[model samples]
Target: MQRPAFDPTAEEVARRVLADIRKHGDKAVQKYTKEFNGINLPPAKFAVPREERLAASASMDLLFKRTASEIFARVVRFGKASMRKDWSMATPKGGVLGEKFTPLARVGAYIPGGAAPLASTALMSVALAKIAGVPEIVACTPCDKKGQVNPYLLHALEVAGATEVYRIGGIQAIGAMAYGTAHIGKVQKIVGPGGPYVTAAKKLVYGDVDLDMVAGPSEIAVLADETAVPAHIAADLISQLEHGTGHEKALFVTPYMSLANKVLAEMERQIASLSRCESITKAAASGALFVVTDNLDTGMEVINRFAPEHFEIMTKEPRRWLQKVKNAGAVFVGAWTPESAGDFVAGPSHVLPTGGTAAFFSGLTVDSFRKRSSVIAFTRADLIETLPLIEEMGRVEGLDGHARAARIRFENPS
Candidate 1:
């Protein structure tokens, strides 16, 4: 499949808007929010009130609320289990060496609500932050023309422990969080997957705030065999394609040309029933492909090179093929495991690296919500043992002061 061109225009627009928001404060945020999302929110009203969040939670159906609770429990349990713990090891010379993990003070999550409300994302992003003990979790999403955000999304955010929720989206929401406006305070880091515009805005503000990854539109790849169900493969492919970005990609790879043809036919039949059929059709035409490799081994090579956001292995032995994959945001093991399972109910956060960034970056986890600090407690013996090494490096770098500072401690014999 052809890699979509990174939007050059998006960067230009984001840069201008971020600068305007940085310099002009809330006024600039409101202007762009109205222009792009049609949400007419004032500075004070940018953040949804706590009463509204509570009401959203209350209004949800009892059965649906119970289902959401079950999913959230799994998400939180996984976060706690996966979180890295602080530990120390004794150094060679009676010194202490270790790492300490601490939760971030404040963070922002961008939930896409333009084409869909994405209630699942509320738990996917903010729930992990909550589990990581982030004191203030701020959420941003686009509101309707009347400035009303999705009630379901608001309810999910509330349940997931969002301390603040804002009715804003697009580059404006990113800009507001990255560079603090009068009302929305700047966050230490920003996370969650978004459309092309949000992705570009996050990139422009990299120095202004830390970001989870260069996450954008969704993409998927499937390494399947003749034994794989054509209907299952087709439905999984269309899932990522319906994310409303025409840039989304869904690659179907198989050694058997017959199986590939069947999956393609199934995609056509299944797409008409989807609400985002127009967007899915546009994505499939431009971004989808089927590669017939020489064998499954060669097919695995093609998959790793593509480095898709979500990868499914539907062969005789999915586990065996899973060992061969190198660059996917997440791997679904069998026909029973679909990408949607990971997005909605799986223990891990759905916010993942996209656009082949999985080659270097990993998906969001509890660790993403915390910062690590290297801990070093040096003994006198440790300082003396490593002093010569430090002196040699300092001498080579021509930093005499660095060496002298250490040498002076030993020079006086105290």
Candidate 2:
């Protein structure tokens, strides 16, 4: 299917799912899972035993296990270093006010188990949560038709330090994790990437629990010039297009028509031999666009407007252009740095904002897993100093109780 342009209507649907889940928890979850995923495992399929989780990892090929572990180690290291300490500040009013950052006590990390199991996502989601100091991290992925979570995903989850792993997917898994079913417990927040239904569920459950951005189909935009290599541009475009068969858009912009056409031709030639050509074709049909600009600045302006999820700058001064880039989930500098580098082993979180949301939303990071509480310390001296102003402000706001409280504190000087 042509990846539909970023859909606000999908958010509406997600809101409905959230309401339905609240009204009828498991029943709604099961109904949606059965209708959408074509699976009916009931709540029994939710939990993946500790033994099974270990077995899943053990079953992996030695090399795969080694490589995944190494990657996990790097991610863990990054997570630890990314941890933020508590902070405070002294106010001019002699009052102390500041904020302390604490990891949520419990968190839910959703890993999409689509046709291609996202073992990498397991690593990203769980490792980040672990580093944030979450005591209980529950993970959920949908089971395949044969009723098993992909063993690789289970292994990744195990390595990433998931306290609880469930073989559930789609809106139901979300509902279960958010609402606490007979089998699954509620979580403080849910994080991951999935199809529209999953996005919808996250939207639906936002107030009940924290959520990441409402992600859309994957996208990559390349800013290339005559000096840039066509093959490199083609490869990068294909790399992103190969992410899925549906509407994953790839754009190549250049100052000259010749280079743009050359890159477009290169894409046609290179795409034919790719394993995911058919998928890429569908994605390209909706996702791909050729943007020709009179100059590099014009291209940069257009790119900033798109604010792609993945942006590659194939220019003479790639490093300089990095500063010009104001909106992007992740920026791939130069031809050598492809989006896939960031997708797998790059230190930054791959769970990024999509659908022009890079304008405001940020990619997943340690901050996403933590919450902040403002701390205010008012000494007797401070309270007495600010009392009149506080009382006047409260009175003007029509809060008699607030004004009285402030008045009492100053009047008694206790």
Candidate 3:
């Protein structure tokens, strides 16, 4: 089936919110925050106090704090490993050409706190930015009706090295970071995942600020055969469904008809016991797909077309099948490696491209926080030797000024 198009109403709402924020700054942001989130606050209350950040950190459960620390360490190691180094090469003309990688000056991380306080997101975006050597990392998240941010989220942001924290959410938070309100400073780029409104806001502000990706709902595709366990497949599908937005997608593709039927039965059985059974049921009805292909090759084709955010290979030869995957934001090699491992503490950022964007965009990485620039250093002889080529190309393009610039350098050569 073809994917559904984005909601026009959400886009229009986001456009209006962004325009208002751009025109009125802090006043507009406060108005929208109260309207959308039901939390009214003055401009001074926009930022979370430093003492609250520390208190949150101190109040965290000991076990939870330890796990978070371990995940942070793993993510940091992965970020450092994924970072690219600068290198230069000597050209045939004795010129030097290379790419210099530099971390962004200031960046904003949007942690989703509407449905749930995504403390892991603070670790994912903020920690990765810190690992990339970013000097300033700012975070924005929604608060409860009481105008209080979640303690776990506050702790996570502080632990991940956020330089600033804001108690704002939705499109207004995005606009405040992108356009810079009286209370919050503008960031060079914005990174994180959000609901439809947030994604639409990011789309509207693309040129104004750099974005990681237009991430939408969560999605997962599982490719399995007879060797795969029905229970595992069913549980994996239900896991993403429990993310509680009915927009989440879960697909199970297989060559064995019996396996497909068994997995479906298992899903029905397992979902009954889940706390979010209603959400799972709604998501399964709208977004789940079960395909029994002619063979493994056809199953693979279906998965590639979907290009899910998370792909799991549960075939007899899972490693061999991995070589054929070209799309997916992240891949799980075997039944032992579930998508949840990558979602939490697998050392890679769980903020992945969704809504089939994995076909073009990539998952979050340390490099996402850095920008690269091409450096060219040419000697006088190198410029003279390349002058004829430059002049000829410039003349062919119908530009006399471009050709004269190259010729002038030679005319006065000492």
TM-score each candidate.
0.97, 0.92, 0.97
The sequence of per-residue lDDT tens digits that candidate 3 reaches over residues 145-251 is: 99999999998898899999999999999999999988899999999988888888988998899999867778899999899999999999888887876788899
Candidate 2's displacement at residue 171, Å, is 2.0
lDDT of each: 0.90, 0.81, 0.90
Lowest lDDT sum, 10 consecutive residues, model 3, at 1-10
Cα shift from native, residue 47, model 3 (Å): 0.7
How many clashing residue pairs appear in each of the predictions shown? 0, 6, 0
RMSD in angstroms, all models? 1.4, 2.6, 1.4
**Candidate 1: deviation at residue 10, Å?**
1.5
Regions of candidate 3 where Cα sits further than 4 Å from its true position: none
Error (Å) of candidate 2 at residue 168 is 1.6
Q: How many clashes does the backbone of model 3 have?
A: 0
In terms of lDDT, the poorest run of 10 residues in model 1 is: 1-10
Q: Score candidate 2 by TM-score against the native.
A: 0.92
lDDT of 1 by residue, 290-387 (tens): 99998999999999999988999999999999889899889999989999999889888888888888888899988999999999999999999999
- The residue ranges of model 2 lying beyond 4 angstroms of the native Cα positions read 1-24, 93-95, 412-414
